[model samples]
Target: MRYVKYAAIRKPTEECIFCKARDEVGKERENLVLFRAKYCLVMLNLFPYNTGHLMIAPYRHVPSLEQLSDEELTELMVLTKRCLKMLREVYRPDGFNIGINIGRVAGAGFEGHVHIHIVPRWNGDTNFMPVIAGTKVIPESVLDTYDTLIKYTHLLRE
Candidate 1:
């Protein structure tokens, strides 16, 4: 939702956006990042499949789930569950489709760094738009979704 049909603001193609966000000290809002934990962080997808599409990824820059430590894995799952609960409370989605695309062969957009995508689904959500025109019509802004998730962070326990 950052750019509506491409109006000239282009992210530098060389750097990984997620890695850049993890390293940046005070660019959370600009990066559309929602929350950060000890090992992992949650952020809105730049090109979302839905209005509230979010992703959780480790900050250590591992390329796969097997590269994660046990503690890091625990935190990732815990926070993932929490994201689901909070998203349900906020969006009241009919269902959710969550998974990790491990490699480029498996459809990983950022194949260099592993991340799990959490997409909220609703009845009649998939229309003929993408099928007919190749554009997904997300009805909300990614920043707005980021703010909504930030507000719900109050409900999460450390």
Candidate 2:
């Protein structure tokens, strides 16, 4: 990963979030990233409820789902299913939350382009931490999770 320093305070350049990831193939110490393809890529969420929380995003920058072509939509769905399958195989979550947030008000962290979130859920996965502390407890680090998923990208293609 190329390091970008702003003034005296250094921070990863946010020129284009996806491009930053694209440029650094092996630089990220975190293992949360799972797969990358021509049209889309999958990465484990740094903060997640369960162990495997993945996000699938398009290579092209499109803010709304309406901006995506039929082919892009098709590919997105296909990738989403594959992600779910791989998560099931690895973590065996009982259910999943799969959808896209069109705008910031809709809960899109990155509003420039629409991406799909695939969150795995097990029975009684929600607990007091979320209800009381208002924070989620994730057992694994994003980097470790990425390494695990990267090892299983082949199964997703199949």
Candidate 3:
């Protein structure tokens, strides 16, 4: 079992992380951005909850879904469906936890920039480590998972 610590506490900054990822367009691998669409983009979670945890957000920063236009909303769900399919094809997890955290009170890591999280889940994926030792056991590293998912980004285009 490989234990991975959670991400370090990030110092408060004015810049939104999603915007940074969107602006650094060409460096997809370095940015962990898998695919970019006209209205939205998909990127791997830097501190993933699972091996293939992914996030989808609009190119334009918005705090909530209500702020999104019809086009942006449509593409968001479209990309989300594609992500689900991609995760299904790659990880073959028994289940998934797909959700959006709209506000800071609702567990939004970046409350100012709304996004959806797609977390791949397997049976017994959790253990006593996180409960007792403050660490989680991840079978693979984030970079390795990024490399694996990068290969499937093309499939998302279709």
Candidate 4:
């Protein structure tokens, strides 16, 4: 699976992938972390549904938003807005699919660490590739996308 591409780095032994990304330092580029806020951080999705796909998660290891304090919740949404603006500025996508999956059944890849997904969509971006060949093509590489967006990290700070 394309998701497994990150397994070598986000090993099963790690307590939580998001926590690891939150704690680990000096590897922002390698980890695809674009920006770090007081309560949340932004990073490109390793197995993105589309180009410029990004995920925003709180620094805390809470599994649900209800567990987060008001400050955390506020910053989470604030950062989400920043991400949307940044994605729009950089990718100029036709539309977007923004959501949070709370559980495994709900499509949370990391059920124990809640996060929001921001997927950029274009008209007719989805084609027969996935239906026929069982593969989705991303026009740009994740690292390349990170590099392209990293310059705009300052937007999140403001």
RMSD to true structure for each model, in Å: 3.4, 5.6, 2.7, 2.5
Error of 4 at 2 (Å): 1.8
lDDT by residue (tens digit), candidate 4, 1-158: 46644543465445776888899977898788988888888998889999999999999988899999999999999998988898899989999999998976786678789999999999999889988976799999998998899988888887
Q: Where does the lowest 10-residue lDDT sum fall in candidate 2? A: 1-10
Q: lDDT per residue, candidate 3, 10-126, as tens digits?
A: 434656779999999688888888899998989988778789999999988899999999999999999999999999999999999999998868877788889999999999999
Report how far residue 129 has shifted in candidate 1, in Å. Answer: 0.5
Per-residue accuracy of model 1 over 1-158 as CA lDDT, tens digit each: 33434323443355777898899858998897888888888888888888778888888877799999999899889888988888899999999999998876787666788888999999999888878976888888888888778888864445
Candidate 3: regions farther than 4 A off: 1-14
User: Which of 1 and 4 is ahead in TM-score?
Assistant: 4
**Residues 1-158, model 2: lDDT tens digits:** 01111212433234545545556678543434567676776776555646888877777788887888887777888889988888899989899988788875776656676788888898988888867865677777777787777778997676
**Model 1, residue pairs in steric clash:** none
Model 3, total clashes: 0
Q: Per-model C-alpha lDDT, please? A: 0.82, 0.72, 0.86, 0.87
Write down the lDDT that model 1 would get.
0.82
Following a full C-alpha superposition, what root-mean-square deviation does model 4 have from the true structure? 2.5
Off by over 4 Å in 4: 4-14
Candidate scoring better on TM-score of 2 and 4: 4
Number of backbone-clashing residue pairs for each candidate, in the order shown: 0, 4, 0, 0
* Candidate that scores best on lDDT: 4
